[model samples]
Target: VTAVIENTAGQGTNMGFAFEQLAEIISQVEDKSRVGVCIDTCHTFTAGYDLRTKVVFDQTFAKFHEVIGWHYLRGIHLNDSKKELATRVDRHNSIGQGFLGMEIFEVLMNDPHFDQMPIILETPDDTLWSDEIRLLYSLIR
Candidate 1:
Protein backbone atom coordinates (compact mmCIF):
# COMPACT_ATOMS: atom_id res chain seq x y z
CA VAL A 1 0.00 0.00 0.00
CA THR A 2 1.24 3.48 -0.80
CA ALA A 3 1.45 5.95 2.06
CA VAL A 4 0.54 9.41 0.83
CA ILE A 5 1.53 12.50 2.80
CA GLU A 6 -0.75 15.45 2.13
CA ASN A 7 0.12 19.14 1.97
CA THR A 8 -1.42 21.34 4.67
CA ALA A 9 -2.63 24.94 5.11
CA GLY A 10 0.45 25.95 7.14
CA GLN A 11 -1.62 27.36 9.94
CA GLY A 12 0.59 28.73 12.71
CA THR A 13 3.72 26.57 13.07
CA ASN A 14 2.67 23.87 10.67
CA MET A 15 5.54 22.27 8.75
CA GLY A 16 3.89 20.84 5.62
CA PHE A 17 2.57 24.17 4.39
CA ALA A 18 5.09 24.50 1.56
CA PHE A 19 6.27 22.16 -1.14
CA GLU A 20 9.87 22.80 -0.06
CA GLN A 21 9.15 21.36 3.39
CA LEU A 22 7.35 18.42 1.84
CA ALA A 23 10.29 17.85 -0.44
CA GLU A 24 12.66 17.88 2.52
CA ILE A 25 10.49 15.39 4.39
CA ILE A 26 10.07 13.19 1.34
CA SER A 27 13.77 13.25 0.55
CA GLN A 28 14.50 11.52 3.85
CA VAL A 29 12.53 8.41 2.93
CA GLU A 30 14.75 5.46 2.09
CA ASP A 31 12.21 3.81 -0.22
CA LYS A 32 10.96 6.62 -2.45
CA SER A 33 8.32 4.59 -4.24
CA ARG A 34 6.70 3.20 -1.11
CA VAL A 35 5.44 6.64 -0.10
CA GLY A 36 3.85 9.46 -2.11
CA VAL A 37 2.28 12.88 -1.89
CA CYS A 38 -1.33 14.08 -2.11
CA ILE A 39 -1.93 17.73 -2.86
CA ASP A 40 -4.88 19.51 -1.21
CA THR A 41 -6.04 22.36 -3.42
CA CYS A 42 -7.42 24.54 -0.65
CA HIS A 43 -4.40 24.05 1.55
CA THR A 44 -2.08 24.63 -1.36
CA PHE A 45 -3.76 27.91 -2.23
CA THR A 46 -3.91 29.07 1.37
CA ALA A 47 -0.22 28.30 1.65
CA GLY A 48 0.38 30.70 -1.28
CA TYR A 49 0.65 28.35 -4.23
CA ASP A 50 -1.63 30.29 -6.55
CA LEU A 51 -4.13 28.40 -8.68
CA ARG A 52 -6.45 31.27 -9.46
CA THR A 53 -5.28 31.48 -13.06
CA LYS A 54 -3.70 29.15 -15.57
CA VAL A 55 -0.34 30.92 -15.51
CA VAL A 56 -0.26 30.87 -11.73
CA PHE A 57 -1.31 27.24 -11.71
CA ASP A 58 1.46 26.41 -14.13
CA GLN A 59 4.04 28.24 -12.07
CA THR A 60 2.95 26.75 -8.74
CA PHE A 61 2.78 23.22 -10.08
CA ALA A 62 6.10 23.65 -11.82
CA LYS A 63 7.61 24.58 -8.51
CA PHE A 64 5.96 21.55 -6.95
CA HIS A 65 7.41 19.27 -9.61
CA GLU A 66 10.81 20.80 -9.05
CA VAL A 67 10.65 20.47 -5.28
CA ILE A 68 8.74 17.20 -5.10
CA GLY A 69 9.04 15.01 -8.13
CA TRP A 70 5.85 14.07 -9.98
CA HIS A 71 6.71 10.40 -9.56
CA TYR A 72 5.75 10.79 -5.91
CA LEU A 73 2.32 12.24 -6.55
CA ARG A 74 -0.46 9.79 -5.67
CA GLY A 75 -3.64 11.74 -5.14
CA ILE A 76 -5.37 15.13 -5.19
CA HIS A 77 -7.94 16.66 -2.86
CA LEU A 78 -10.13 19.08 -4.79
CA ASN A 79 -11.27 21.69 -2.37
CA ASP A 80 -12.06 25.42 -2.39
CA SER A 81 -10.75 27.60 0.38
CA LYS A 82 -12.87 29.94 2.48
CA LYS A 83 -9.82 32.05 3.27
CA GLU A 84 -7.81 34.19 0.92
CA LEU A 85 -4.50 33.29 -0.67
CA ALA A 86 -1.49 32.90 1.66
CA THR A 87 -3.78 33.06 4.67
CA ARG A 88 -2.40 29.93 6.33
CA VAL A 89 -5.94 28.86 7.20
CA ASP A 90 -7.50 25.48 6.48
CA ARG A 91 -11.11 26.44 6.01
CA HIS A 92 -12.80 24.59 3.14
CA ASN A 93 -15.70 25.74 0.99
CA SER A 94 -17.88 24.20 -1.67
CA ILE A 95 -16.36 23.89 -5.11
CA GLY A 96 -16.32 27.20 -7.00
CA GLN A 97 -17.94 28.92 -4.07
CA GLY A 98 -14.92 30.23 -2.22
CA PHE A 99 -11.78 32.22 -2.80
CA LEU A 100 -10.73 29.77 -5.51
CA GLY A 101 -12.97 30.38 -8.48
CA MET A 102 -14.44 27.77 -10.83
CA GLU A 103 -11.86 28.26 -13.54
CA ILE A 104 -9.14 26.45 -11.64
CA PHE A 105 -11.40 23.51 -10.98
CA GLU A 106 -12.38 23.44 -14.60
CA VAL A 107 -8.74 23.50 -15.67
CA LEU A 108 -7.77 20.89 -13.11
CA MET A 109 -10.51 18.54 -14.21
CA ASN A 110 -9.03 18.65 -17.67
CA ASP A 111 -5.37 18.51 -16.73
CA PRO A 112 -3.82 15.25 -17.88
CA HIS A 113 -1.20 15.27 -15.15
CA PHE A 114 -3.84 14.22 -12.61
CA ASP A 115 -5.54 11.68 -14.81
CA GLN A 116 -4.24 8.64 -12.96
CA MET A 117 -4.32 10.11 -9.51
CA PRO A 118 -7.20 9.53 -7.13
CA ILE A 119 -9.17 12.75 -6.98
CA ILE A 120 -11.04 13.35 -3.72
CA LEU A 121 -13.56 16.06 -2.92
CA GLU A 122 -13.28 17.73 0.50
CA THR A 123 -15.95 20.38 0.33
CA PRO A 124 -17.31 21.92 3.51
CA ASP A 125 -20.90 20.98 2.72
CA ASP A 126 -21.32 17.26 2.50
CA THR A 127 -24.75 17.56 0.91
CA LEU A 128 -23.21 19.36 -2.04
CA TRP A 129 -20.79 16.55 -2.79
CA SER A 130 -22.93 15.01 -5.53
CA ASP A 131 -23.51 18.34 -7.19
CA GLU A 132 -19.84 19.16 -6.91
CA ILE A 133 -18.91 15.86 -8.51
CA ARG A 134 -21.25 16.53 -11.39
CA LEU A 135 -19.89 20.04 -11.73
CA LEU A 136 -16.34 18.75 -11.87
CA TYR A 137 -17.24 16.10 -14.41
CA SER A 138 -18.88 18.72 -16.60
CA LEU A 139 -15.58 20.61 -16.67
CA ILE A 140 -13.86 17.78 -18.50
CA ARG A 141 -13.95 18.97 -22.07
Candidate 2:
Protein backbone atom coordinates (compact mmCIF):
# COMPACT_ATOMS: atom_id res chain seq x y z
CA VAL A 1 0.00 0.00 0.00
CA THR A 2 1.14 3.51 -0.81
CA ALA A 3 0.70 6.25 1.73
CA VAL A 4 0.15 9.80 0.57
CA ILE A 5 1.76 12.28 2.94
CA GLU A 6 0.01 15.56 3.51
CA ASN A 7 1.22 19.03 4.48
CA THR A 8 0.28 20.16 7.98
CA ALA A 9 0.04 23.82 6.97
CA GLY A 10 0.77 24.61 10.60
CA GLN A 11 -2.49 23.00 11.53
CA GLY A 12 -3.38 21.09 14.69
CA THR A 13 -0.91 18.36 15.48
CA ASN A 14 -0.61 17.15 11.92
CA MET A 15 2.23 14.89 10.98
CA GLY A 16 3.84 14.07 7.60
CA PHE A 17 4.73 17.69 7.07
CA ALA A 18 8.31 16.62 6.39
CA PHE A 19 9.69 13.83 4.24
CA GLU A 20 11.44 12.36 7.24
CA GLN A 21 8.15 11.91 9.03
CA LEU A 22 6.79 9.90 6.15
CA ALA A 23 9.98 7.88 6.08
CA GLU A 24 9.61 7.11 9.75
CA ILE A 25 6.06 5.95 9.26
CA ILE A 26 7.11 3.66 6.46
CA SER A 27 9.89 2.28 8.58
CA GLN A 28 7.47 1.26 11.33
CA VAL A 29 5.19 -0.63 8.99
CA GLU A 30 5.54 -4.42 9.31
CA ASP A 31 5.15 -5.17 5.64
CA LYS A 32 7.77 -2.72 4.42
CA SER A 33 8.15 -4.29 1.01
CA ARG A 34 4.52 -3.67 0.18
CA VAL A 35 4.49 -0.06 1.35
CA GLY A 36 5.52 3.06 -0.55
CA VAL A 37 5.06 6.80 -0.71
CA CYS A 38 3.11 9.19 -2.93
CA ILE A 39 4.40 12.74 -2.90
CA ASP A 40 2.11 15.64 -3.59
CA THR A 41 3.91 18.48 -5.39
CA CYS A 42 1.97 21.31 -3.82
CA HIS A 43 2.34 19.96 -0.29
CA THR A 44 6.03 19.36 -0.85
CA PHE A 45 6.56 22.89 -2.13
CA THR A 46 4.59 24.52 0.65
CA ALA A 47 6.44 22.45 3.22
CA GLY A 48 9.64 24.24 2.04
CA TYR A 49 11.13 21.79 -0.43
CA ASP A 50 11.38 23.74 -3.67
CA LEU A 51 10.85 22.03 -7.04
CA ARG A 52 10.39 25.08 -9.22
CA THR A 53 13.98 25.17 -10.47
CA LYS A 54 16.21 22.41 -11.80
CA VAL A 55 18.85 22.90 -9.12
CA VAL A 56 16.28 23.05 -6.36
CA PHE A 57 14.44 20.11 -7.86
CA ASP A 58 17.57 18.01 -7.86
CA GLN A 59 18.32 19.00 -4.29
CA THR A 60 14.79 18.25 -3.15
CA PHE A 61 14.75 14.80 -4.71
CA ALA A 62 18.20 14.11 -3.34
CA LYS A 63 16.90 14.87 0.11
CA PHE A 64 13.94 12.58 -0.46
CA HIS A 65 16.25 9.80 -1.57
CA GLU A 66 18.37 10.26 1.49
CA VAL A 67 15.37 10.25 3.80
CA ILE A 68 13.03 7.78 2.13
CA GLY A 69 14.84 6.21 -0.82
CA TRP A 70 13.69 6.35 -4.44
CA HIS A 71 12.31 2.83 -4.37
CA TYR A 72 9.65 3.95 -1.92
CA LEU A 73 8.34 6.53 -4.35
CA ARG A 74 5.21 5.00 -5.84
CA GLY A 75 3.34 7.95 -7.32
CA ILE A 76 2.92 11.72 -7.53
CA HIS A 77 0.02 14.04 -6.74
CA LEU A 78 0.72 16.66 -9.36
CA ASN A 79 -0.72 20.01 -8.41
CA ASP A 80 0.38 23.65 -8.46
CA SER A 81 0.22 25.52 -5.18
CA LYS A 82 -1.91 28.58 -4.55
CA LYS A 83 0.59 29.77 -1.91
CA GLU A 84 4.25 30.66 -2.18
CA LEU A 85 7.08 28.38 -1.14
CA ALA A 86 7.35 27.52 2.59
CA THR A 87 3.97 28.99 3.41
CA ARG A 88 2.68 25.60 4.58
CA VAL A 89 -0.65 26.28 2.91
CA ASP A 90 -2.54 23.39 1.32
CA ARG A 91 -4.30 25.09 -1.53
CA HIS A 92 -4.30 23.69 -5.08
CA ASN A 93 -4.44 25.58 -8.35
CA SER A 94 -4.55 24.70 -12.01
CA ILE A 95 -1.36 23.65 -13.78
CA GLY A 96 0.82 26.55 -14.97
CA GLN A 97 -1.54 28.99 -13.31
CA GLY A 98 -0.32 28.93 -9.71
CA PHE A 99 2.74 29.64 -7.59
CA LEU A 100 4.56 26.52 -8.79
CA GLY A 101 4.30 27.65 -12.44
CA MET A 102 4.85 25.33 -15.41
CA GLU A 103 8.57 24.69 -15.30
CA ILE A 104 8.38 22.26 -12.38
CA PHE A 105 5.77 20.09 -14.08
CA GLU A 106 7.77 20.18 -17.28
CA VAL A 107 10.85 19.01 -15.45
CA LEU A 108 8.96 16.27 -13.58
CA MET A 109 7.18 15.00 -16.70
CA ASN A 110 10.51 14.68 -18.48
CA ASP A 111 12.37 13.07 -15.61
CA PRO A 112 13.14 9.39 -16.08
CA HIS A 113 13.06 8.68 -12.35
CA PHE A 114 9.28 9.05 -12.40
CA ASP A 115 8.80 7.44 -15.80
CA GLN A 116 6.34 4.69 -14.87
CA MET A 117 4.87 6.23 -11.75
CA PRO A 118 1.31 7.48 -11.77
CA ILE A 119 0.97 11.26 -11.66
CA ILE A 120 -2.45 12.49 -10.54
CA LEU A 121 -3.90 15.96 -10.96
CA GLU A 122 -5.47 17.67 -7.92
CA THR A 123 -6.26 20.99 -9.46
CA PRO A 124 -9.30 22.95 -8.21
CA ASP A 125 -10.99 23.81 -11.47
CA ASP A 126 -12.98 21.02 -13.10
CA THR A 127 -13.45 23.10 -16.25
CA LEU A 128 -9.70 23.25 -16.79
CA TRP A 129 -9.04 19.52 -16.43
CA SER A 130 -8.80 18.93 -20.16
CA ASP A 131 -6.35 21.78 -20.61
CA GLU A 132 -4.33 20.69 -17.58
CA ILE A 133 -4.07 17.13 -18.83
CA ARG A 134 -3.03 18.32 -22.26
CA LEU A 135 -0.48 20.69 -20.80
CA LEU A 136 1.12 17.95 -18.71
CA TYR A 137 1.28 15.60 -21.69
CA SER A 138 2.84 18.30 -23.83
CA LEU A 139 5.69 18.57 -21.32
CA ILE A 140 6.77 14.99 -21.91
CA ARG A 141 9.86 14.80 -24.05
Candidate 3:
Protein backbone atom coordinates (compact mmCIF):
# COMPACT_ATOMS: atom_id res chain seq x y z
CA VAL A 1 0.00 0.00 0.00
CA THR A 2 1.13 3.56 -0.64
CA ALA A 3 2.15 5.36 2.53
CA VAL A 4 0.97 8.96 2.53
CA ILE A 5 2.99 11.04 4.94
CA GLU A 6 1.17 13.24 7.46
CA ASN A 7 2.25 16.65 8.67
CA THR A 8 3.11 17.09 12.36
CA ALA A 9 2.45 20.82 12.48
CA GLY A 10 5.79 21.45 14.24
CA GLN A 11 5.20 18.64 16.69
CA GLY A 12 7.42 15.60 17.41
CA THR A 13 5.32 12.63 18.43
CA ASN A 14 4.38 11.57 14.93
CA MET A 15 6.59 9.26 12.83
CA GLY A 16 5.41 9.77 9.24
CA PHE A 17 5.83 13.52 9.05
CA ALA A 18 9.23 13.19 7.41
CA PHE A 19 10.25 11.47 4.20
CA GLU A 20 13.05 9.73 6.07
CA GLN A 21 10.38 7.99 8.08
CA LEU A 22 8.85 6.59 4.93
CA ALA A 23 12.29 5.50 3.74
CA GLU A 24 12.79 3.70 7.02
CA ILE A 25 9.47 1.93 6.61
CA ILE A 26 10.34 0.98 3.05
CA SER A 27 13.70 -0.37 4.11
CA GLN A 28 11.98 -2.86 6.39
CA VAL A 29 9.72 -4.21 3.67
CA GLU A 30 10.87 -7.37 1.89
CA ASP A 31 8.93 -6.70 -1.31
CA LYS A 32 10.17 -3.22 -2.11
CA SER A 33 7.79 -2.75 -5.02
CA ARG A 34 4.81 -2.97 -2.68
CA VAL A 35 5.76 0.23 -0.90
CA GLY A 36 5.38 3.75 -2.21
CA VAL A 37 4.55 7.36 -1.26
CA CYS A 38 2.00 10.04 -2.21
CA ILE A 39 3.27 13.47 -1.31
CA ASP A 40 0.76 16.17 -0.38
CA THR A 41 1.90 19.62 -1.51
CA CYS A 42 0.40 21.37 1.49
CA HIS A 43 1.75 18.85 3.96
CA THR A 44 5.21 18.85 2.42
CA PHE A 45 5.40 22.63 2.49
CA THR A 46 4.15 22.92 6.04
CA ALA A 47 6.56 20.17 7.03
CA GLY A 48 9.40 22.46 5.88
CA TYR A 49 10.09 21.34 2.31
CA ASP A 50 9.91 24.33 0.00
CA LEU A 51 8.55 24.10 -3.56
CA ARG A 52 8.37 27.79 -4.42
CA THR A 53 10.85 28.53 -7.22
CA LYS A 54 12.28 26.12 -9.77
CA VAL A 55 15.64 26.13 -7.98
CA VAL A 56 14.15 25.38 -4.58
CA PHE A 57 11.79 22.90 -6.15
CA ASP A 58 14.73 21.04 -7.64
CA GLN A 59 16.57 21.14 -4.35
CA THR A 60 13.58 20.02 -2.31
CA PHE A 61 12.79 17.18 -4.68
CA ALA A 62 16.48 16.24 -4.81
CA LYS A 63 16.34 15.88 -1.08
CA PHE A 64 13.19 13.81 -1.40
CA HIS A 65 14.90 11.57 -3.95
CA GLU A 66 17.90 11.25 -1.70
CA VAL A 67 15.86 10.12 1.28
CA ILE A 68 12.90 8.29 -0.23
CA GLY A 69 13.90 7.49 -3.84
CA TRP A 70 11.69 8.55 -6.75
CA HIS A 71 10.68 4.97 -7.59
CA TYR A 72 8.58 4.92 -4.45
CA LEU A 73 6.54 7.94 -5.45
CA ARG A 74 3.18 6.53 -6.40
CA GLY A 75 0.87 9.54 -6.40
CA ILE A 76 0.40 13.23 -5.59
CA HIS A 77 -2.17 15.30 -3.73
CA LEU A 78 -2.45 18.82 -5.11
CA ASN A 79 -3.61 21.27 -2.48
CA ASP A 80 -2.55 24.79 -1.62
CA SER A 81 -2.10 25.54 2.07
CA LYS A 82 -3.93 28.11 4.16
CA LYS A 83 -0.90 28.18 6.44
CA GLU A 84 2.62 29.43 5.87
CA LEU A 85 5.75 27.35 5.36
CA ALA A 86 7.13 25.43 8.35
CA THR A 87 4.06 26.24 10.40
CA ARG A 88 3.34 22.51 10.33
CA VAL A 89 -0.41 23.11 10.43
CA ASP A 90 -2.37 21.16 7.86
CA ARG A 91 -4.93 23.40 6.22
CA HIS A 92 -6.25 22.91 2.69
CA ASN A 93 -6.87 25.92 0.51
CA SER A 94 -7.97 26.26 -3.08
CA ILE A 95 -5.18 26.21 -5.67
CA GLY A 96 -3.53 29.60 -6.24
CA GLN A 97 -5.52 31.14 -3.40
CA GLY A 98 -3.26 30.15 -0.51
CA PHE A 99 0.33 31.00 0.32
CA LEU A 100 1.57 28.37 -2.16
CA GLY A 101 0.59 30.66 -5.05
CA MET A 102 0.71 29.27 -8.59
CA GLU A 103 4.29 28.71 -9.75
CA ILE A 104 4.66 25.44 -7.87
CA PHE A 105 1.37 24.17 -9.25
CA GLU A 106 2.50 25.19 -12.71
CA VAL A 107 5.78 23.40 -12.18
CA LEU A 108 4.14 20.22 -10.94
CA MET A 109 1.55 20.33 -13.69
CA ASN A 110 4.43 20.21 -16.18
CA ASP A 111 6.70 17.84 -14.25
CA PRO A 112 7.35 14.48 -15.88
CA HIS A 113 7.31 12.59 -12.60
CA PHE A 114 3.67 13.45 -11.99
CA ASP A 115 2.54 12.87 -15.59
CA GLN A 116 1.65 9.22 -14.99
CA MET A 117 0.54 9.43 -11.38
CA PRO A 118 -2.84 10.01 -9.83
CA ILE A 119 -3.20 13.65 -8.84
CA ILE A 120 -5.99 14.08 -6.31
CA LEU A 121 -7.25 17.56 -5.54
CA GLU A 122 -7.85 18.48 -1.90
CA THR A 123 -9.02 21.99 -2.50
CA PRO A 124 -11.66 23.28 -0.06
CA ASP A 125 -14.28 24.08 -2.65
CA ASP A 126 -15.75 21.12 -4.51
CA THR A 127 -17.63 23.42 -6.84
CA LEU A 128 -14.37 24.71 -8.26
CA TRP A 129 -12.82 21.35 -9.09
CA SER A 130 -13.72 21.70 -12.74
CA ASP A 131 -12.26 25.17 -12.94
CA GLU A 132 -9.21 24.08 -10.96
CA ILE A 133 -8.64 21.13 -13.26
CA ARG A 134 -8.84 23.40 -16.26
CA LEU A 135 -6.49 25.89 -14.64
CA LEU A 136 -4.02 23.18 -13.77
CA TYR A 137 -4.08 21.79 -17.29
CA SER A 138 -3.53 25.27 -18.62
CA LEU A 139 -0.31 25.46 -16.57
CA ILE A 140 1.28 22.68 -18.58
CA ARG A 141 3.94 23.97 -20.93
Q: Which of the numbered candidates is closest to the native, going by highest TM-score?
A: 1
Give, for candidate 1, the lowest lDDT window spanning 10 residues. Answer: 26-35
Candidate 1 lDDT over 18-110, as tens digits, reads: 898998888888888788999999999999899998889989889999989888889999999999999999999999899999989988888
Native-referenced Cα lDDT, model 3 = 0.83
- Provide TM-scores for the models: 0.97, 0.92, 0.91
Candidate models: Cα lDDT each: 0.91, 0.84, 0.83
2 or 3, greater by lDDT: 2
Ranking by lDDT: 1, 2, 3
Task: Name the better of 1 and 3 by lDDT.
Answer: 1
Report how far residue 1 has shifted in candidate 1, in Å: 2.4
**Residue pairs in candidate 3 whose N, alpha carbon or C atoms collide under 3 angstroms:** 9-88
- Alpha-carbon error at 55 in model 2, in Å? 1.0
The candidate that achieves the highest lDDT relative to the unseen native structure:
1
Over 4 Å off, model 3: 1-12
lDDT of 3 by residue, 3-76 (tens): 54433435456566687877887889888867778788898888888887787888988998999888888888
Residue 115 deviation, candidate 3, in Å? 1.3
